[model samples]
Target chain A: MKKVIGLWFALVAVALIGMSAVQTEPGLAVGDTAPDFTLRNIDGKMVSLADFPDAKGFIVTFTCNTCPYAVMYEDRLIELHQKMAAKGYPVIAIQPNDPEVQPGDSFEKMQERAKEKGFPFAYLLDEGQEIYPAYGASRTPHVFLLDKSRKVRYIGAIDDNPQDETGVTRRYVEEAVAAMEAGNEPELTFTKAIGCTIKTKKKG
Target chain B: MLKKAIRILGVVGALSLSTFLAAQEEGTPFPFTVYETYADFAPVMAQDNDTTYVINFWATWCKPCVEELPYFDSLHVNVAQKPVKVLLVSLDFRRDLTRKLVPFLAEHPLKPPVAVLLDGKYNDWIDKVSTEWDGAIPATVVYQGGKRIFHGEQFSSYSELTDLLAELKQ
Candidate 1:
């Protein structure tokens, strides 16, 4: 009886530990160092954050072709890159959706979309479904603004109004860059917006 | 000849009126009510009743959300005798009501009350709905009295959904 009770307690302890592990597995938070990665760009070139030696910071946007929320922000992303690239902060767009799950976000479609939109930034693919989980990006169009030291300064949406661009009240990404430029932390370090969940294969 | 022409006109008018009625019944906008702000839609999320409310946040563009929709419908039907309510809150763009959402509903035809919450300010209300949610679609909130549970992932099957409700009842 004593041995059986001990085994039951052991099983309960193991269950508790497993539950905690799953619960605490969250993406990188503010002040955490953004992991540098080498991903395939739409132009068939390998791109990395290290390539931009002179950049003050980066606007790392996790987006894909099929998500409507991502589509709504495509032109805005282009505009953001065009405006912010010269100011030492360039947008690094990464397609995080698995091609097998969402064929529209395949590398070929990504290249086609980039060429059609004339994207001024590096539109890369998160091959093998690796980088996004590391960054803890849960949805498409999720932004992670990193400073010169590759520290995550801000995380979340591009702006307040995702439905209509003209109706936007707060531009979160732009303001974060401006705050970094002024040698101060972003006033709003984090925000949220409704977005399509990042596509991934079901675990067996 | 004049009497014959008048009879033909009346027949034509009657046929057109029936066609119009059929069209109205077929394309009656899916009975979805649109809420422009989260504040306006807060009451639905915070109902203080004994009924178990299963509120799902979804959109037409979200593939997983669309896939799991029938599960919610099935749950609604399965629990018809119980004090449970299933509400589908679409995060679809307000502009897509005519172009996308309504048409999608016309094709799929879910058996639960569907509401369109077009509030763009997600940061403000995401925590209000469930602090555990990260503003992702296919998120479900099941509440009864004061106990609430939030699931941030999709239900793979109808049993998975019913199991959740069963847990909530416990």
Candidate 2:
């Protein structure tokens, strides 16, 4: 009877552990082929990487509406799109927060924000929060720059300065785009910054 | 009349300055050290000691970070028999040290020693903290005598944390 009870307890513990493990792969690194995704833009249109066939590359930035860090970079993102989209590198902003978790980042709010801000780029909603995990994006305002061949050339921040634009001495994304334009590899591939965690649906 | 006005202004300034310092002293309940650079903080991370260090990077504004802090506090208190050292590092901006961080600490007292990492140019030191870190907050790093493990997720329960600690020990 004692042996049976012990075995039952051990099995219960193992089952509980297995259920709680969240398997999240790390963010895609440089030289990796950027995964193509088709998400709904704020205009209620489905946008895919293949939609921009004539483009040189993409500035895939995982950002949201609620995060203060993301809010701070909103204008700069628009500026990046205006400056670089004509240069063949367009900014593709994706709202990665699960609506059930963060209501502020819901599709409705994203649409409102885009219309209010007059976003020059495609502000898409990653419905069900599936796309960010594939890209390994853990935070809002996390940037992944892909080249024309859909290869991830850079993965990190838009610049070293997150607080103040005037204080930005190193523009990481701009430099990366410039390098691709000149046929030279970007000097810095990966960088880090303090950002809000990408909101996901609460687990049972 | 000008001299008298100048004297009154000086007295008011001096009084307000003293009050500000007193508030700062009362705000922090734990042994809080402010590091202006990563060079000053690198030693704390690489401490090759017998005690297991439970280091959590957090901020006052982060909702999930604040939610999981009590677990670390409870771990600091309950794990008295074990040689554990809990360090709460505040990634709050330097300007918020007095305004937001100090007041938050005052409201919710934590048992672990806290520190403010006021280093700029985060790209330089984030990899040093953990290469796996995508610069997310509420990240925990458990280390003991060269054995280290990094988690970029919030600990929903104390058992989850203890499980990680036990795994790192092995």
Candidate 3:
């Protein structure tokens, strides 16, 4: 009986560890060192955060093709890139969804989307689905704004109104970029949005 | 003879109307409320006495969210005697209501009451729903009395949902 009870306790311990490991890690917060990554762009060129040394900061956004929330923000993301790139905070969109799970977000579809949308910024693919989890991206359209020092200054949504552009009360990304430009801390460093969960190659 | 025929037609119309009404009451199952903002939807999340509220956040576009809906419906019916209420909160875009949500609901007529959370500013309310919620769909929040439990994942089976509810009931 003593041996059986010990075995049961051991089983429970292993189960708890497994559950904790798979639980979504607490996402990166303001002032955390943003990890650098080199990923392939839609044009088949490798792009790295280090490549844009002259820029003030980077708007690292995880987004995909199939998600309705991502689709709704496509035009706005492009517009944001056009408006902010010149100011030295360019938007670097990354497709974090595993192509196996979301076929529409495959590399070829990304190329097609870039060509059709005339994207002003580089849209990269997190090839092995390794980069996003490190940043703790739980959903598509999750944004991590990093300063030139590669320190994550803000994390979360692009703005207040994802449904309607005209009704937008706050531009979270825009403000973060402006704050970085002015060498001042962003007023609101974090926000959240309802988006499609990021796809992993296999369920954990 | 004309009077008798008229009376027969009137009776038939009355019978059909009552039948239609009965089907409406049974088949219609649930009704939805539209919330234009997070503030507008907050009051519904309030804790009530002696009742367990099972609220599931979902969208029509999300496949997994649609897949596990039957479990909630099943629970709604199976737990009819228990003080439990199931609320299916749809995160579908306001524009897609008539085009997508309504039609989908018509086809899958859920037993649980449904609502469209029209809050455009998700940042304002995602945490309000649950601090642990990473804004993932198919997420569930259960409230029993004043205690609340949130699960930011889908229920793989009816038993999985029942198990969670059972825990909350205790």
Pick the DockQ winner.
1
lDDT per residue, candidate 3, B30-147, as tens digits? 2478888878888778867888899999999997799899999999999899888899999998788766876676556689999999877788788898998988687999987678
Worst 10 residues of 2 chain A by lDDT: A18-27
Cα lDDT tens digits, model 2, B3-62, are 999798777656655555586688733237899899999999998989999899998988
For candidate 2, give the lDDT of residue A11.
Answer: 100
TM-scores of the models, in the order given: 0.87, 0.83, 0.84
Listed per model, the TM-scores of chain A against the true chain A are 0.89, 0.87, 0.86
Docking quality level of the chain pair in candidate 3: medium
Tens-place lDDT per residue, model 2, A36-110, is 999999988999999999999999999989987888899999999999999999999999988888888889999
Please tell me which predicted candidate would have the highest TM-score against the true structure. 1
Reference contacts reproduced by model 3: 0.90
Q: What is the lDDT of residue A16 in candidate 1?
A: 97
lDDT of 1 by residue, B19-85 (tens): 5445557875345788888899999988898899999999888889999998988888988998999
lDDT of 1 at B127: 94
In candidate 3, stretches whose alpha carbon ends up further than 4 angstroms from where it belongs are A1-26, A201-204, B1-31
Q: Which runs in model 1 stand beyond 4 Å of their true positions?
A: A1-23, B1-30
Listed for each candidate, the true contacts retained, as a fraction, are 0.82, 0.80, 0.90
Local distance difference test values of all predictions, in order: 0.89, 0.88, 0.86
Check candidate 2 and list the clashing pairs: none
DockQ of 2: 0.54
Candidate scoring better on lDDT of 1 and 2: 1
